[model samples]
Target chain A: MALTNHPSETPNLSFLKEKALQLRRLMLVQAAGKGQGYLGQGLGLAEFLATLYHYELRYDRDNPEWEDRDRFFLSTGHYSIALWAVLADIGYVSKESLPTYGADESPLEMSTIEGRVPGVEMTGGSLGHGLGIAVGAALGYRLSKRDARVFVEVSDGELQEGSTWEAATAANAFGLDNLVAFVDCNGIQADGAMVVPIEPVADKWRAFGWDVIEIDGNALDQVVGAMHWARMARGRPKVVVMRTKPGKGIARLEAREKAHFIRVGADEWDVIAKELEAENA
Target chain B: MLKGRTLGMGELERIEDRPFRTAPFAAGTLAAATRCDRLAVLTADLGKYTDVHPFRDAHPDRFFNVGMAEQALVSVAAGLAKTGWTAYCTTYGAFATRRAHDFLAIACAHGGAAVKMFAGNPGLTTGYGGTHQAIEDLALMRAIPDVTVIDPCDATEMQQIAEQAIDIPGTVYCRLLRGNVPVVLDPATYRFEVGKATRFGEGGDVGFVSTGFMTERCLDAARKLETQGVRASVLHVGTIKPFDAAAVAEFAGSVTRLVTAENHVLVGGLTSLVLDAMQEAQILRPMLKIGIPDRFIECGSVPYLQDKYGLTAARVHERVAAWLDRSGTSAAA
Candidate 1:
C-alpha cells in the first residue's frame, strides 16, 4: 500500500543537459582530486545516469526513502565515481561531496552504497547481484499491484556472472513488465575487453524473453526514447543496451586505457582544471 | 508438527498429503502476503523439495522454476531484486553451499541484494547422502559480512521465522527441509526471534548449545539425561551469522562443561561458532563437539549416519557424561 504511481510533472530537457555537463565536470574533478579513480567507467555511464535521474526515474529527491518510487540498482560498484557525480548533480548530495571521492574517512567508499546513496536502491560492488534484488523489488511492486519500475544498471563484464542470466531468465518467466535493466556496453572491463565478446547483446536479451532495445548512450534523446519504449512494453521485462564510450567527454582520456584509471599528479591539477574548463566552454 | 500438506512439483504435477516443511517456504508465504507487489518465488527446479511450490502455485505470475542451475538460481533472484523484486530462490542446501556460493555471497549479500535463499536438506535432514547434505552451509554463509543466517528447529519455528525474515535488511540463507516435519518446541513456550538462542532445559552440570536438525536430537538427549538423574541444559541457536557470543559465553561460564551439536562439520557451523564465542568472551571451558567430522559422510540411512557421527540422543548423552566425568562434575540427583 505504501507503493504509489503519482508521477511528477515533466522537467525541461535543457536543465537535464546542463546537469549532465555539471555531472561530467564533477566526475572529472573527483578523479583528478583522487589522483586516481574509475574515471573511464564513470565517464562511460554518465549519460545513462543523467537520462535516468533527470527525465525517466520516478523518485522523491527530498525524501529518497519514498516507498512507491522507482528503485535504481547500480550492480557494478566501481562506477561509484560516476554515480557520485550524478547524485551530486541532481542534488541527492551536495556538489561538495565530490572532493571526497576515494577519501579514507568519507561515507563514499568508491562503492555504490545502495539505499545509503539517496537514490541508490541497493549497495553494489560485487557484480551479478543487482538483478536478483531488482527482481525481488519488481515482484514486490507487482504483488502490491503498483506500477513502479525497477531499473538496474549493469556493466558488460557483469554479464559474465551467471547471476545476471539467472535474473534475466526469471524476469522473463515472471512477466515483470515493470522491470528494466540498462547495460553499459562499453566493451572494456578490469583487464582489457570482456572475454568471449558480448556483442549481439540485444539478440541475447531477446532470446531470454525480454523486450530488448539498443541505443547510443551518449545521446540524450536516444536514451530518453529507449526509456519511453521500455515503459510502454507489455508482459516481458525490458533491457536497454546502452553502447557508450569510456572516458566520454575528455578527449585525451577517451582514447587511453588510462581513462580506466587516470591518476593525476598534484602539480598537474592546474592543467587538468584548465582543460576541463575549456571542454565546458 | 504440521502434516498432510502436499508437495507440488511444478505447474503440471502435484504430490498429495506429504507433510511438506521448511523455513523459507513459510517465510515466502508471509513475504508473499506482505510485499505482494515486489515479492516473487523462485526455485532451481526444486519447487517441491525446498517447499516453494505452494507460493508458486498461489502466485503463478510471480513464481518461476529456473531449471536445475544453482548458480543461476541465486543470480536470477539477485537480478530480480535488482529490478525491484524481492525474490526468494530455493534449492538443495548442498547445491547452494557448494555451487552457488559466489551468487549467495557477492551477488545477494555483499551486493546488498534483497534476495532470500531457502536451501533444502540442511545438515543430515535429507537422509539422501553426502551429495544432498549441507554440512558446511553455515560456514559458507558465515564469511559474508552482511548476510543473515537462520536454522529453524521445526515446522512451527520455520513458519514463524519465515515471517520474521522480511525484517532482516539483506540476503538471508536459511536451512530448510521438506515433508513430514516434527514439532520440536511448544508454540506457547518459545517464540520465533532471530539472533536469540532458545533455552529448552535448565541445568548446571553441562550445557549443549546446538543448531539445525541436531538441536532436536540434543533435546531428546537432554530428556534422556534427565531420566538418569542428570540435569543437562539445552540451548537452541537458530541464527549463526551474528553469532551470539555473549549468550554462549554466559552459558559456558555457568556450566561445568560445554558441548555443541549440529548436523554439520565440527570444523565450522555450531562447533566453530561456539569456539569463536568462547575465544571472544575468554571463557574456555572443556568443550566437546558432537557432529560430523571434517570428512564427507558415506551414503547410509539417516539414523545410521546420526549414529556414525554421534548425533543421536544416545551419543549426546554418552558424550556429555564422558565430559562431566573428566570435569569432575556430578550429575544432579
Candidate 2:
C-alpha cells in the first residue's frame, strides 16, 4: 500500500530531534513515577519511536485499528515507556494517563499488552514473538491485497531466541517486502551485559535473506533515512540494526553499571527533570 | 489411473478396514473454506499428515506451511486472527501443546483470537515414543482460559467438530484422530454440541464415561457388559473444557457405580475431570479409572499400547466388572 501521508515536504530534522528529546523526557518522567522500569531501552528507543510516529508511519491518531494503517509492533515489550511517550505525544493516548503507568489496574502496563490498549498492536515482553506476528500481519495484508505495512521493533538480546531466526527465515521465504524489523542493539539484557555474543548481527540477517541496514539509532537523520530506504526496498523483508546508547540525553543514567532496569530516587527525579528542562531551553 | 499400479482386491479390502479419520477433517475444512473467505489454514510442515492438504489444495492463497517452527505456526496464526481472519493451524499433538503452548496462551487465548488448532496423533495413536505422544495435552490446554478443548471420538464426530469449531469464538485445541480412524458414532441421530455429553446407551449398574477414541471403546465395552448380564451406560464427553457437569452428574446419579476411560493419563484428564465434577455435584460413587497410568508410554504399535495402557474395550469391561465386584454393586445389574 502506498503511504497515506508520506512526508512529501522535506522532513524538518531539527523538529524531529526536539520531538525525540521530548519523548525521552516523558519516558524518564513515567519511569520516575513508577520508581523503576525498563528505562534504558525506553530512552534508547525514543528517537526511532518519535521519528516513526511523527514523520514516517502512516496512522490515524483517532483510528488506531484502521485497516490500512501501518502497524508498529513493539517486539521489545519492556520498552512500553518509550511507546507510551510517543502515543501520548501523538495524542493517541491522553497525556494525563502517563503517570498511571505500571500501576495496578492501569492500561499503561510496564509491558505492552495489545487489545487492552489502543495503538498497541500486540502483547510483548516475551521476546522473539513480535517479528513472527509481523510476518503474519504482512502476509495477511498481502492476501487481502491491502498495502498496509508491518514494522516490528526487536531488541539485540531477543536475537538469542531460535524463534526469531525462524521468523527471519519465513519472512524471507514469503518475500514479505512490506515487513520491516528494527533491532534495538542497546547492548544489555536482564542478566547484565549480554553473556552470549551475537556480533556481526547484520551478517546474520543478511545471511537469512533480509535486507539489512545498520545505523546509529540515536541519530534522527539516519533513523529517518533508513526508514525511507526500507519502504522502497522490494521483494525482501527489511531490518535496521539500531546501535543506540543505553541512556541517551541523561549523564547519570547513562553512566550506571546496570542499565537494563533502572530505579531512581524521588530527589534524583527532580534533579533529572531540571536537567532536562535546561537542555530543552 | 494405471491398472498395474492400482491396489489389488485384497489390499483394497484391507484399506476399507482402516478408515482414514483425517479425511473428514480435510473435507470439513474444505467445506468451511468455501463458505468463509476469511478462513485460513496454516501448518508447521504437517499439512499432509494432519489432512490440511485438502484445504491447501482447494485454497492455495489462504494456506501457509510454516516449515516446522511450531511457535511461529501458533503466533503467526494469532497474527492472522488479529486481522479479523479465522485461522486453523495443524501440527502434531505433542509439538502443538508442548512446544507452542505459551504462544497459544498469550497470543491467541488471552486476546480471544479466532484460531482453531487441530492436533494430530493424540496420545498412543503414534508409536514414535514419548517425544511424539501427547498424553498431557488435555491438562495443559485445559489450564488455559478461553480455549475450547475437544477430543472427538471418531471420524464422523471429527468432521462435525471441525465444522463446529470454526463458529466457536475464541481459540480451540482439538485432539485429532488422524489416519485410519474408526467409525463408532452414527451421524444420523448424533449431533455434536460444544460442551454437551452424548449418551449412547442406557443401563443402571455402571456409568462408563469416556472421551476421545476411548469413548468408542466404552461403547463397545458397554455392549460386551450387556452380554455378561452387567448393565452399563455409555456417555461420551467430547468437549473437555466447559465440561458437561450436569450430564455427568445425571449419569452418575442414575448408576450404582462409575468408570472413566480415556487414552490420556488418568491424572488431570477425563478421569480427573469426571471425579472433580462428581465431587462438586456431591454424586459420590465407587469410581475405577481405565487409562494410561502416571508414567511415560513405551514406543509400540497402537494395539500393543492400547493393551499395555488398559485402553482396549475388553480392558474397560474387565476393570468395570472388577470394580462392580469390589464395590458390591455386581448384583445391581
Candidate 3:
C-alpha cells in the first residue's frame, strides 16, 4: 500500500531519523527551561512522534482546524513536551513558545489542554481517556464519511486504568478501522518501575479484537512501517505496541536512574544536547 | 398477596407496559434528530431503560451503545462533540455522576464539548435501592464549573428541555425521571428558560421554592394551602447550577415565610441554594426545609420512599401548615 501524505516521495529513513533527532533536541531544551518535565517519555517517543507528525499524519500546519485533517491525540498528557516540539517543528506553533512551556499564563502547559493549543485534539492529563475519545472521533468520522483517521498515543502504564480496556472493547465493537492506537511502553511510571507489571500487553489488545502490531518505537523505519500497515488494515481497530527505551538518543540520560521525571542541572542539559548532536553527526 | 391486588406474573407484565416519564425524552430526541443530521444518540447499555430505544431504532447508524461502560459513554460523547457533532448520551444517575464524573468533568465540561448527558432515576425515583438511586447528583454536577445543570419537573418540561439542551452549547447534565410521570405544568404558558425560575402562583404569606419533580408537589401543596386561608406563592426552579438567584430573591422578598422543597437530600440541593441566595441578598425570614434529611434512605417502592422522606404534596402541605401555625403568619387577603 502507498504511504499517504508522507513528506518525502521516497522512503527516506535518514531524513526521518534526522527529524527525530531534531524533536529530541527541542524536547531537551523545553524540559531544561522548566528545570523539570516529562523528559524521559518525550525523548523515548521522539522517533514515533516525528514519523507520525512529519511523515504519516495528514495535517495542515497553516490551518490546524481544517475539516478533513487526521487527528493525533496524546493520551499520556505529560508528554506535552514531545507534542509541543513536533508542533513547533511543523509550524503549528511558534518555535519561541517552546521555552514558556509549563509556565503560568502559557498555553503550552505541562499537560495537553485541548483548544488551548492548535494541534491538541483533547485535554489528556488524566490517563485512560484519550483512546475512548479517539474511538468516538473515529466513529464520528465514519458516520460523516470523512476519510480522516485518528491516531492516539497511550502509555503502557495507562493500561492499568479500566476505562482503557472499556474503550478498546467499544472500538472493536464499532468496527472503527479508522482509529489507530500507539501504546508507548517505556516501562517507567511515576512510582518508579511498573510495580505490578502489565506485561503481555500485546495479547491484551489482541484479545480485545484489535489488529495488533508490536515494534521498536525508537527505530524510525519500524515506526513508519507499522503506521502504514495500521492504515491499510480493515474491519477492526489497530494498536502498535511501541516498546522503547526511556531515554532514546543521549547515552548519559539513558543510563541515569529514575528516568520518569528527569531533572538535569543547567550545565548537564548542554552536555546532553552536544551528545545528541555528535551522535547525529 | 394483598386483597384485590394483582401480583406475580400479571403485575410484572403490567409494570412493563406502564408509561414512563422518560418517553418524552425518547420522542423529543427522535424529533430533533430528524431535523439535525449532526445529532447522535448514545447510551451505556441503557437504551430501553432511558427511553432512547426509539432514537436508536430511527437513527440506527448514528446510535451507539458503548456497553455498560459509563466512562467510555461520556468520553465517547465528548469525542463525538469535538468532531462538530451534537452528541447525547444517557445512563443511570448513580453511574453517570459517581462512576464517570472525571471523564464528564475533563472530557466534556473542561473541554467545552457540546455533549448533553441525560441522567435518569434521580433521587428517590428508583426502587432498586441506594446503589441504583442518585440523590446527590445535583450537588455533584452543580459543583462542576461551566456545566449546565437542569432538573425538569414533568413530561412536558422534560421534552422541551431535552430538545433545547442540544442547542445550548457546552456540556449539560439534565436529571431525567422515567416511568409513569405526571404532567403538572401547563405547556401553553410555561416558558422554559435556562437560568430563570418561573412563578406559578402569587401569595404574600410564604414562598414555596422547589425544583425537579418536587415542584409539581409544591404546586399541589400551594393549591391545598389556599383553602386553609394560607396564601403560598409557588416558584419552580428548573435550572439548578446557573440558578436564577435574582428571581428567587425577588420572590423571597415578597413573602413573609420561605419553605424550600426538593426530591433530593436537603444539604446540597435546592434548599442549600435558596439559603445561600437568601443570605447573599440578606432576606432573612422564617424558613423550614422539607426533603430528605441528612441520611441514606432505605430502598422501597417509589410511593413508600416518597412518603417516608416527606416528598409528597400532602407531606409538604402538612409541613408548611405546621410551620405557619407555629409562627402565626396570617394569610394574605
Model 3 C-alpha lDDT per residue in residues B1-333, reported as the tens digit of each score: 223332111001112332444377877788778678899989998777888888878889889999999999999998898788999999988999999999989999998898999998888776667787788889999999999999988877888887788788799999875545566766677768899999987887878999988887888889888877888788999999899999999999999898898878877889999989989999998889987777777766666677778987878888788778778864332
- Candidate 1 residue lDDT tens string, B1-333: 223322221111112432334333555465555655567777888776666766766678777787777766777677566555676777888998898887787767766777778777777654556787788888888878898898877766777666666567779888765555666676567687778887876786678899876677788878877776777788888888777777888888887778888878877687888888888888877778888788876655565566667877777777777667666765443
Q: Write the per-residue lDDT of candidate 2 for residues B125-226, one digit (tens) a residue.
A: 766678888898999999999999998988888888778777988999998766556777777778899999988767978888999988878887888888
1 or 3: which has the higher lDDT? 3
**TM-score for each predicted model, relative to the true structure:** 0.84, 0.95, 0.95
Cα deviation in Å at residue A12, candidate 3?
A: 1.6
Candidate 3: stretches off by over 4 Å: A1-9, B1-22, B330-333
How much of the true A–B contact set does each candidate keep? 0.56, 0.50, 0.72
- The DockQ figures for the candidates are 0.33, 0.70, 0.81
Inter-residue clash pairs, candidate 3: B19-B180, B20-B179, B20-B180, B21-B179
* Model 2 error, position B192 (Å): 1.4
Tens digits of per-residue lDDT, candidate 2, A14-124, equal: 888889888988887688879888888888888898788878788876677788888888988888988899888987788888888899998999999977778988889
Give the candidate number with the greatest lDDT. 3
Indicate the residue-level lDDT of B154 in model 3.
83
- Classified by CAPRI criteria, candidate 2 counts as medium
- Candidate 3, residue B187: how far the Cα is off, in Å: 1.7
